[model samples]
Target: MPPTEAADTIVALSSGRPPAGIGVIRCSGPQAFAAAQALAGSLPEPRLASLRHIRRPGSDMLLDEALVIAFPGPRTATGEDLVEFHCHGGRATVDAVLAALVEQPGCRIAQPGEFTRRALVNGRIDLTEAEGLADLLAAETEVQRRSAMARAGGAFRRRLDEWRERLLALSAQAEVAIDYADEEDGETAPDLRPAIAHLRQEIALLLTAPRVEPLRDGVRVVVAGPTNAGKSSLINRIVGYDKAIVTPIAGTTRDVIEIPVSIGGIPFLLVDTAGLRATGDEVEAIGIRRAKEQIEQADILVWLGSPCEKPAGAIQVASKSDLAQPAERGGLRLSSVSGEGVQELIAEVRQRAAALMPKGDELTLDRRQFRLLGDAEAALTRAASLSDALLVAEELRTARVAIDAISGRAGVEDLLDSLFGKFCLGK
Candidate 1:
């Protein structure tokens, strides 16, 4: 859809699909109350739920018995008049209620994310908060939930506002210097280097923040090494099930088998890849290539080998420890069958994963926000080197615009569709 005002009333099944105890249908727009009153006899006081018999418009047919609530706007979620119908979650009943709602003159089915889009357009939330809401809805791990919640709760907004305020102040000072350069006293421009340098330092810290994307998308940990090294056995033990097939054959496993495991509440994709070695078999060669790719992309690589074999720079694990006693190596030694030292191995993995996570209370930005921040940082860096007051002020303004884009104050028209397009219907 194009960037335009949302003037029509939209109705959608806010609650997920049928066969539950209750379903929520939300309506937002100018005619929200009228639409709800048409199907369900009369609405209770605003924000109060009233039990009523919902029916087909202009007919005696009873659709369902439901609880209806009205929220007069400028105070509701969408900042518009809204109503909700809490009805039985049976598929037919929910469908019937929606059918009756759409029959109203100004009511129509809501598009994907229309409710949240309306919320954004109506100034109920900013771009960063909206993105955080999206992340919260899709979060799969404890750390992901905490990060998303913090962003959605306006932590990032608060930090961005501080930076923008400082930049605005500096820009104003530069403009004043240019305005007074010709004064009788011959006043010179104030030194802005200190403030500019401080702001740059802040941006630099954010740029180097611990990786947050991996926390959202589960970290990949690939088990790699030569064939018959108990790689599959280790994966199965870690996942606590038979996820990958293990056999006596040298090259039985010929593909990457991935299973998600959470250690210390952090999500990880434990991948068992085909053993790495030179092979003439066409299928085995393909598997080996895929294994190499997985290793390159993995956040952590576990090199599985015998006690006598070792590889540099990988978290070495002595697999099949029951067959040969491991020497005093720096890496871990565990037997998948006997479960020796498995907990220790998991603890080590957890420590490494935690090291990669961003510290709590730190401002985290998604890809779009990070890119804009980068632009602002570059502008500020350029501004620091300029001698002319006018040029410095112009660069500061450029930097300010970039910061504004993160919170939807400017330059967000083109991004609306793609950003909200990922949300499920009815928000």
Candidate 2:
């Protein structure tokens, strides 16, 4: 049934690209039930899947036989009437069904993230949950999935709601105090310093936590050593494939080669760099310069050079250990060909990388989220120290605005387009 005539009904293939086992076509809005009824002739009971024949309007041309489910308005995923068609996964089948649905009046193909954008607009899920859904869709590694799951479960939104409630209470107190400043000595504003101080301390601790970037993009582990130190071979061994060209000759790898791999559920990028040496070739010099830059940016440095020359905190490796007798060294001695100590070195890198990620189910924040929290924390800090009720109220408002921006409750109109753009069609 149509909820309203103003809103456009949207339909999209919510499942993966066709040619799979099944395709899920989702429709939501006021006209969703009408469109579904037009094709199926009769609609199924809400939330119950019923097999139906999908056909063109005013014709007996069968589009596809599909299982259909209807969801009535206001409690659905988009907070509107919704329908889904579980149809055969062939491309032609999906295209034909979609054409039939869109041909109905007020029906149109959904834009990327439109369904989810509707979910956000209609108050079904907040921005933090939306962001979590985005991350879940794009997640390629185990840890990333875990982090996104926690976020999509509304952990951040729940916490922010608590904070927003307290802010409103404090704001009301400040208003009352201002309205009766001279007239009522008996109606003193409750001391908000205690709550303000406590809130600020909690937010400060979160500000110290790891950023979400390293988890999204794998942690960088750059391999650096002088020429012919077996840097290329070592990386190929760790990555389980030939990511870099290997040769006995020095200077063969005159550039940086990066390979991304997941170890023990954590993502890592193994970077093979040009051998460091004094080279007259302009190209080799440029490669060396880039290698140095990569080293500076590395989260973990694997040094295959002499132990004494290794940079601070580098994972020192005595390369080509198969050809040379084992040396008495505290660090690792590895042979890429023999596979000795390769797993240990990899374990070490993974251990180091784990510390940089969001710890088991910790709600991590992105760049924008971290910045907004920083703003809110600062406002709370200012509010805690102020004795004037009016000034404290002003600071609390600032904090609330910052917090609201995160949940898409206020001041987030500009963010919707860009944020939803990241989502795939039908999300």
Candidate 3:
């Protein structure tokens, strides 16, 4: 049975590929059961699988023998009656099944993330959880999976809630002080000066966390050094594959070769660049320029020669330990070919990336979040700069509005669309 209040039933291929052992077609919304019936000829028991022949509409054409499971409304994903058909995996079979369902009135294709969006709209999950679900689906490493799981489990939401509560408390205190301005003992009644200062400092501290970047992404590491330092070989060893061309030719790599690899469950963009050197050739010059650009932009630089040149404000790593004697300058020495100090390098990378943002920190994950947090941070900082309580209150309100933008508390429809609309269909 479908819930009368449910939305229009939508269907999509739940499992991506076909021609496998099984294929899954998911339908959600009010008419989910009806759509399933049009294809399966009968509704399967709720949450239980039953074998049936899925046929095309107005014809005896058998799509495939499949197992059907029906979930009644308010208990399934999207809080609507959802149906699943496990058919023999094949593109033709799945498409035929979907076509039969969509041919029915009130049945339509589910848009990308429509199912998850329904869950969010129906109060089954929050925005943070929705983001986590997406992350979980896209996670490629154990660390990424764990982080996404933590986020999906509402750890991030709890942190956001705590930050919001602190701000709310401080705002309430400021409001009281503003309202009681005429009281003889107004200064002592609400005592917002200390509270506001505390809240501002706490927010400022949280804004320093580095997890903001790697929380949903990976770090970028560029292997840069003078020629013949085994840059390509090191990259191959790190990734455990012969991805980059390795040879004895000097300046062989004339362009940036970037590979997305994970170490110790930490994702990193490993870039092998043209040997950094004085070059006059146009192509080599461009590669050198790009190498420097990557070096400047990378989270860490793996310097691959003796007497490595250090980049200011970046971690320096000395590679090719097998050839060079144990001479320490200011960077860690490593030999990717010999697997020496590789474990330590991986650990250092994880630790440094983690150190970017401290735990319990709440900052923006992308440029949008950064801008919003920056606005709020700036507002609060400006407010703190002013000693006047009234001005402080106004500034606090402005900052609060900025923070609200990040949490969708201020009704940011455009932001929601931009964030959630990128998800795949049937998410």
Candidate 4:
């Protein structure tokens, strides 16, 4: 069912700018089909395209020839009567069509993500799916696309549904125990302790889902080591481009050079820093300081040095291995010149970065969403540890509310404002 006609009708250019061959002007609400019919001179069949000459409503002035399509209530993108006018992709033509839409009764400009927000508010999509739609818009890699697809496809909902069902069952069992304990015949039911324990374990497992934020956002890998260890060369090798200067001279890298690269389906911001060494030259000392700072800030620290002693901490990599094979202390050996261990280094980098990240089920591109999940998880943990059944039930209910906030099932205020605030208009 549509929202109780509380919101006004909204209209916007859905296809966006630089109108290729066509631009789509979309409208939805109680007045959607009527608005379309008023401007387009009768409705196109629902969900089917038809040619129509769009003109100013009540005026014979031709605006543009367009393919008009109508989607009636409950079958449309917003779960309302939605109509789209595919006009010529010119800025003027699109603007003229939008002008026509606003002239209709009860129509106004669509807010940022208003269309998807409608889908959310109308129960057409949950919060995660709504986030997925936005994530899809900004996805830049295959891994990102897959992560967004999972969220869009109700992975969060599936997880929550399982948790909610378990909680509900436990609550029901607890209630039955309380309700029927006084009965003379004494009704027996499943034990509450095991059920609660099982629920806690499942929740914990979900809380530990593979973290995909780096993939969803981007991963940062820093290349650092003593001078002449081929840090810049290793960077170029990993990026498959000579992005950084490589020289035989020590302290060649005196400043941090960061470049964004994609590797093994993951995005990487590769940082090539000045060699780390106890330097006498002021400039070289500064570079060493900066290198240590970059390493500390990096998502994955790649410590490159001579093929001699392995670093006590950090992921040690023996760069310039073509000269001499280094002792392996569960270390990665690589030769930027020969590409030795480059593949292994890349895999290890991604694996280590992923290990430090939160799980995929917990991977929320939206920072606010992740925080909410964390808050809810904390509440759930506290709730699960309570000995009192009623308190546990209350805490579980609170946890469910937080989960719904992420799912957008809680009808949060300013949600559209917060979401669309970040988007460009007419998107």
Residue ranges of candidate 4 with Cα displaced over 4 Å: 1-6, 165-190, 222-258, 263-265, 271-299, 302-313, 316-347, 350-385, 411-418, 423-427
Compared with the true structure, what per-residue lDDT tens digits does model 4 show for residues 66-183? 9998988776788778888888999899988898888889988877777777777687777778767777787775556666777678777777667667767666766665555546
| Residue 246 alpha-carbon offset, candidate 1, angstroms | 13
C-alpha TM-score for every candidate = 0.72, 0.74, 0.64, 0.69
- Candidate 2 error regions (>4 Å): 1-6, 182-187, 208-210, 220-265, 270-351
User: Candidate 4 — which pairs collide?
Assistant: 127-407, 209-359, 209-360, 210-359, 210-360, 211-358, 211-359
* Model 2: residue 382 alpha-carbon error in angstroms: 1.4
- Residues 1-427 of candidate 3 have per-residue lDDT tens digits of 1222245778888787777767788988888888788888897778999998988868998889999999997876788888999888788888888888888878888877778877766767667677767777877656566666765776545665676777777767676666666575635644565666666676676566445345455577788887777789878888888988888888889999989886665567888999988877889899989998988767777776445366665555677677766656556677877888777776776787666532432323544555666777787777766655677778877877877666556666665576567777667
Locate the minimum summed-lDDT window of 10 residues in model 2: 1-10
lDDT per residue for candidate 2 within 359-408, as digits (tens), equals: 74888887788999999999999999998888999999999999999988
Question: On lDDT, who's better, 2 or 3?
Answer: 2
The parts of candidate 3 lying over 4 Å away from their true place are 1-8, 37-76, 79-81, 86-93, 121-123, 165-189, 193-219, 223-256, 259-268, 272-296, 303-424
Report the lDDT tens digits of candidate 1 across residue range 1-427: 7663577899999998787789999999998999899998888999998999999989999999999999999888898999999999999999999999998988899988888888878888878888888888898656677888877887677778899899989999998878876563776778897789789879877877655566776677888988998899888888888989999888878999888877767778898999978889999999999998988877788888643554445688877767765455445778899898788888877878777776654557666787888999999898888878889999999999999998888978778888788889888
Q: Each model's number of backbone clashes?
A: 0, 0, 6, 7
Per-residue error for 218 in candidate 3, Å, reads: 5.3
Q: Who wins the TM-score comparison?
A: 2
